[model samples]
Target: MRNIFIFIIFISMLFVSLSACQKEDEKLKGLVIESSSVEFGSLQNPEDRELHFRVQINDYGMESEQEYKVRFIIQDAHISDLIATEKIEVPETYKTQLLRNDEARTIVTGGSKEIKKDFTIDEIRKIIEKDEAVIIELYDKNRTIDREVVTTFAENIKPLVKVNPNAKLEHIKLKETNEIDIFSRAISDSNKEQGISYIAYPEYTFSLAEESYFLWVTENNGRIMNTKDTYTIYSLSDSSLKEVKEVIDKK
Candidate 1:
């Protein structure tokens, strides 16, 4: 009788362990990182000498009960072993939200999300080389969701500089049209009011001459709020930007 009882307990424990393993497998299998990379472009620094780069987050993941946090580590990959790196944090949403009154089904085949984080290229120059490999790894706790490696060519690096945010916005019409426009056009916009968040105040900025400008990025009820540079400001004035350009391309 004692032997039979011990065997029964052992069988039950084995079943429980198997079930737990299966659940964890399902959670990991469903989350996919389609691609991870860095984007190079004109940055939003005042001196106009800085280059811009951002980590591109293109991923597919299963819906969860609530918002989850994911991290990206930027590392050097040109050597035999991974070298210098930096960390960036991002918050993501899963499909676990309750459906609306008009909704019918709760099951979704898959969900896709795109995210980006901007950084100045000058900071990481020590680890950069000609055609050097830049590796970006994505993780949730100790589990690695995905990894991407990119080679740099013709990328520039320099000492970081202080962009003049204190440049005053003078409220005066231009006598002669030239470069410095305190308030320029908003290259993009948040279609909905909810997604709008301003990172750079309009009055504190001087126009950067790059073809592509920057803006504060946030989301509203599933809508993304970001703006680019459209045109140049003709004059230097301290006037309220809203009165001049309407949208000052907040970065």
Candidate 2:
């Protein structure tokens, strides 16, 4: 008789565990995001630019009363600064089952939502520079599941260049040499319709003897052309411009 009572208790505990497992599966799962085009826009319309995308909520494993708050963001790829954002609320999915003459059919409602946002080229430029990437993401309020795409804003934007603070110019005194703004130079070339391909990347600018020059590192080698002397500077890695500065100091 005691054995029978113990068996009954064990069966009850197993049934309770199974019920708990089933209840845990009632959370919503699938949320997807899709976009028509990754490119923000072209340089043709410099004044106006727009971003378009879509968000989809799948009803396959969605819960009956589950609600989701979705957020869309356009952020800088290098720095996660928010450029633009939009929020949306998705209600619980409604489903209906119909049976007629031994035939059963299920109809699902509430799935996809279209999101369209208008932005300016200036807004994108403020976030990301030329040749740099921008990130567009769609995520739920929980931030657990997200979809993102990385794309460049425009090809015509000037590359971001700044003085290398870590660079040491021991050979030249500070008053004797001036810092050259390579970004402005690239913009000037672009304005002339000559394109900025010449000074796009891996380039260093320095002023020596009141003459500004650019040293371009190509094919693992950098060339600096001057009327006085031409220096062949080899770069071990393109990660830093300090090597270029070191060579200049040595010369």
Candidate 3:
């Protein structure tokens, strides 16, 4: 009888352990590092030379009873040195909330963060020149969820400079125009209110002057956001009409 009882207890414990492992696996499957990018600070300011990078994370799992935390580590891949670290927490109630009434289903979710580090212009240039300039790793505790090795910073790094108010603002106007276009066509009819953002690079004129920038139109519908130069838009369904129009006019 005693032997049978002991076996039963062991079997129950093993079942619980297996269940927990499976739950964790499911949660991880819903999580991802959606996108990452590097932004350079003002080049003319000797005291304010810096590098700012953003990492966007998303969790597509069901609402959790407990809070969870994830981390991102950036390193100089060539030298094996740590550059920066960022942490994001998903609160206990953090999950996509859907509103289903008379209109379309509006899903609301948010998760994004930015890290800034000071580096000299020369140091920054040299660091990015390496074949593998930067290595970004995402961790859920000790387990690595994702790893991205950036070979060249040419496409990722967008240099910033002081704006001359008096100069013609053609590029800024163009970016605003693009945002309005997205707002009118894609966002106006849907359940989402449009919000557009971008990182503008210093315009270069070798052959002919052209507008250069990274634009993102978000309609908050999911947990993940993209922060790269690409034109991938997120469906985040919350924003004010006045705010977007103001941005267009001010630009």
| lDDT score for residue 203 of model 3 | 30
After superposition on all CA atoms, how large is the RMSD of candidate 1? 17.5
- Candidate 1 segments whose C-alpha is farther than 4 A from its true place: 1-35, 39-53, 58-70, 77-85, 89-132, 152-251
Tens-digit per-residue lDDT, 116-185, candidate 3: 3323344555665554455455444565555565433322323223334365433434344555464443
Go through the candidates in order and give each one's C-alpha lDDT.
0.36, 0.37, 0.40
TM-scores of all predicted structures: 0.27, 0.29, 0.29
Clashing residue pairs in candidate 3 (N, C-alpha, C atoms within 3 angstroms): 219-235, 219-236, 219-237, 220-235, 220-236, 220-237, 221-235, 221-236
* Regions of candidate 3 where Cα sits further than 4 Å from its true position: 1-31, 42-47, 61-74, 77-130, 150-251
Estimate candidate 2's RMSD in Å. 13.5
Q: How accurate is candidate 3 locally (lDDT)?
A: 0.40
The total number of steric clashes, by the backbone 3 Å criterion, in model 1 comes to 8
The reply for model 2, stretches above 4 Å from the true place, is 2-20, 23-58, 64-69, 72-81, 84-186, 191-201, 206-251
Model 3: how far residue 29 lies from native, Å:
5.7
